[model samples]
Target: MVYKELTGTSVRLPANFTGKRFLTIIALNHAMESSKPVCSDGITRDISAALIRNVTLEHAAWTETVICQKGLPYLLQSNLQKVPLYNSTTCLSKCNLIAETTLADYFPATHISGSKDHDISDFICQFLPLYTNETLVYLPNDHIVLNWEVEESGSQVDDFYVGLGLDATEKDSPSLVDYISTDRKPYFKHRHEAIGSNELFYIFIKTVNKAGLSNIAILGPFLIDQTPPQYKYIPRVKISEESILFAWESDTFYDDEQTAEINQLAFQFGRLSCV
Candidate 1:
């Protein structure tokens, strides 16, 4: 059957039909002209119908099943496709098929709409810069905690992938090779033993939405130092007639030496009573 109008039409089949039936839908841009005689010229012209460029086809199928005692109609499959309607004059671009959703053993009372209104640009604008800020805190036993605050208004986060690498500017694909995958959470714990001590590392957080769109947030060139400072040599004390001096040498990690500095010296003495 052919549907000429740009509106939906419902067709009922015979009750005796039991095999699978195929349906084809086509959307045309211009209305087809009738073959009736309009002009006095004896020449005949061929009229062709052009198809609309951006055409989307949506279909849903279901089957009735008798399980136990109740007969329920379960949704078999539902799909949305951007029909690739192209002619010799115009070449249409290819687009990835939007994600599909399957409902089993049940169907909604009303029609469910797809994300056709939400375009790629809208999706990026709403979900870009996934997090406002991130925090990394060091813990004992070569462990650390990472936390971040996500934007309140946007697509919900589906999963998070945490990556630790030496190169902060590395691309997402290679950096996330050895990563820890987790669900939607504000914080993630990672052990530093795998990276070793006295080395700089960067933490990358990748947030993914239900539609598979992703954004990456990078934090740090953090230096992992589990080692503590130690005294290089024993302190030397020199007592003079007018002054007392004390000196000592110590060894500390490079990162610690940059921040920890000795600014003051204190000496405590006890009073002696002479007979």
Candidate 2:
């Protein structure tokens, strides 16, 4: 039996099996258990099942056949429905587009932080189309709006103007709000009540140009009741009777991103004498 450390699953095989066959058996078992047959690594469950179907694996071969026929028939049928087909004419046509446009870095660096009672807002997140040239007048003017949804609640919103208002809410759903600014800065301010543990809210930005074409950008998921980060502590060192001692607060008081500078200052102070 081979044990998988990550998923806590095991695969039992004949004692005679070793090396590549042993590896294959483990991969197939994990795929069956996890249902995630696709992986970045080349060794995936689908590939393992395919090999087992064609090759003879002693006693394991019968088990693989039973699994393929019974355990995965529904999944295989669903997969077969998604296979794309192209005719000779469509495949022969020359493609003009050099590269397809994508929202690779659509998320902004800023994020909303703090608790429900003191919800803090980040500056406006911005996005631009990959293939657009701003200097061209015919490109059309674009307007952005804040969008949000409730996590695990299947609730959605089309778009909202910049500014804070209790615009959208439903039974068992997150209340949708926005903060719009007219000072020429494109950003939305979001605020909400305190959330319980495991509660989540999803927020994003959507843009529509004058041409009526729309594109969406995500700000990622937001969680509630997260422990607020503490301010970093600077350590102080003291030496007496050839023994050295360091002291600092156990609780974090300040929350800043200057960890490197704080470390430098601590090290510099440690090297100095207080006698």
Candidate 3:
């Protein structure tokens, strides 16, 4: 008669027995394991007064409500015995029956004040477009793709909010009103022109679960570069009888704090016939 999914602070017991008197016991499972000698005489005596109850039934069908603490395992037992009139003693008779059951608290207790301190890092393990180097560089017109992974435990995530700001402090303490709500998809895409150009920005993500627990994750100090490289002066060419030389001057573009160098250069040669 084990109850598998008991939750909250109370339990209802409906019983149908053919006895004049009944004894009910509800105690923590750990306490019951250590104090098994209380029922040595089969009459369930010497038990804690608070954990035991005596019930006299007027009808065969009866309901009893037991109050208990949440988030713990408990053992419940009901014994139907006979009281002899001659000896005035309670004893187990041939018709006596004992029913034992184990009850488990399914829903763990939640503290509203402590929920705000929950570690969001456990919920989101990874965030995309991370700044590995000095900065995560991107072009102004490029679509920024953000992706992440959520932990499998705890309550399901009900909503996601993303925030983009120009400073790290903004990411640390993001305003919910400034954040954009998103679906449960693991990835979100920021379309071109959605963000301003040539600015360093930080990304903040907040996840709220169905239980009202929320956590925030921060990523980036990414840079969006709108300026392109430009030539400082016109190219100069030198031609000799057997060889040719080409040279040009250009302004350096600093990417990753390093001067951008040309990886390759191409040229085409053609012969013109005199008519």
Candidate 4:
């Protein structure tokens, strides 16, 4: 339920980028390039840590553009065709090393404009692709619902989806599950009763600004067995003197270290019927 925890360094972008004006959301879908050793807030942190800052401080999806500046390198739409997104940890943690040059180079001052902004402010862009990676877990019987809270003025979001696919097993594939996005909700749930017992699935969250999924929350691990249950039903007789003795295989114990299931049952029965 926790998102938007920023911990790295950020500087006020050049005045021309924003025209000293309104805010826009930037989502990077790429990794930052730098020759220098990575650090967080200019201090040496984990280089392996990822850069996961949100792109837009305050804005929506419609009013944005990737303006190809004159003679500047443009991001190829075909580049986006390559799947298996940038490498980073799970959702909500860490910073990826970024350089001023890298940021400026990727999102050079472009004339991007839309409805929300009357005047197109020079925008700030990052080197990495934001908002492309989203994660989701679905609950049935109402299946899902997003958090109905607003954090910032521009925290209103609604670009996401949720569906189920069976081919995506093992954590190595682009998950087949999708969730509809909403605003300011740590977790959004818009679908209903979508998961099946036989299906293996994944969920994707939508981000308008350049965002990354970091150290996400953990889930439950269920234990299951394919073997059937073994039982013993016995009847006994009332007797004046009774002594029962039973012995079974000690090997019929289930061990956590073992890969097999073991069960043992033994009983002594005495029966008497009289007229």
**Local distance difference test values of all predictions, in order:** 0.39, 0.26, 0.39, 0.27
Stretches > 4 Å off in candidate 2: 1-104, 107-185, 194-198, 224-244, 247-275
> Candidate 1: TM-score?
0.38
Clashing pairs in model 1?
none
Worst lDDT run of 10 residues, candidate 3, spans 58-67
Q: What is the lDDT of candidate 1?
A: 0.39
Candidate number that wins on lDDT, 2 or 3: 3
Q: Is candidate 1 or candidate 2 better by TM-score?
A: 1
Count clashing residue pairs per candidate. Answer: 0, 10, 0, 40
In Å, residue 101's CA in model 3 sits off its true spot by 52
What are the candidates' C-alpha RMSDs? 25.8, 29.8, 29.3, 25.3
**Per-residue alpha-carbon lDDT of candidate 2 for residues 1-275, written as tens digits (9 for 90 to 100):** 45444544643444553122224322336456644443223221111100000111111100000001111110101011111112122211211212321211321112122311111111110111112211111100112233232111211222322322121222122255343323322344333443333443333334333223333333222323233345565566689788878677754354232111121123233455853
Writing each residue's lDDT as its tens digit, candidate 1 over 1-275 gives 32334445654544343222344444444576434433333222212111111111112111111111022211112121111111111110111111221111112222224322334223322332211112122222346565555552335466777777677676375352366786766567765566655555566667675546666655444544454444445567799888987766543212352233332344555586322
